[model samples]
Target: MSYRQKQLVMQYAEINNVLDFRLKPELKEALNNIHKQLRKLDDDRERIYLEYSQKLA
Candidate 1:
């Protein structure tokens, strides 16, 4: 869970503190951004590893 989720849960533990509808779009955007960043990182890591491996081969 994100920091926002933790804060919400701490403030409203009952009923699992359902998310407010208004934040849904923002949450989706944040998730999309994270996925894009992670994908880029993975691609870069793989490319760098291959580059080094080829050099040592």
Candidate 2:
């Protein structure tokens, strides 16, 4: 696999481990919310990058 793909896989594993750790319900909910927001931001970044790359081509 490509270096970028490997890095993303590792990052996802780390996030999963963090979510698995024992924590209160409120804190867990907050963390899950943050994760959701981060995923959305990543999606946005990928979309912008794709647009820029297409424009360059």
Candidate 3:
């Protein structure tokens, strides 16, 4: 898996970890922020790849 895939896997693990409600509110907010950033990263990666492939074509 690539770096972003690894990050997504780790994020999945983090989500599982939080499912038990063991984290504090601030920590939960931070995790949510991380989730948002990761999603944006994924979106940006897709856009970049599309642009790159078009350039190659």
Candidate 4:
């Protein structure tokens, strides 16, 4: 990979790890709420991402 690509990949990984650690509890709570609200939904991953993205925006 190019240097810039490598740098961006590393930065993304670091940010993802930090966000994972810092927001894990809140993410879990959001997931639980989503599950409760939409019992028929089968995709937890997408649901969590959508919820978190909405919250971040």
Candidate with best TM-score: 3
Worst 10 residues of 4 by lDDT: 34-43
State the lDDT of candidate 2 residue by residue for 1-57, as single tens digits: 245455655665665676545663555565576567567667877999899999999
Q: Which candidate has the top score in lDDT? A: 3
lDDT per residue as tens, model 3, 1-57: 268767876875776577556555666676777778778888888999999999999
> By descending lDDT, how would the candidates be arranged?
3, 2, 1, 4
Q: Kindly report which residue stretches of model 2 are placed more than 4 angstroms away from their true locations once superposed.
A: 1-23
Which candidate model has the greater lDDT, 1 or 3? 3
lDDT of 1 by residue, 1-57 (tens): 245445444543432344673655565555555556556666777899899999999
* Each prediction's whole-model lDDT (CA): 0.59, 0.65, 0.75, 0.55
CA RMSD, predictions in order:
8.3, 5.3, 2.8, 14.7
TM-score of each: 0.59, 0.57, 0.61, 0.31
| lDDT score of residue 2 within candidate 4 | 42
> Compared to the true structure, candidate 4 yields what TM-score?
0.31
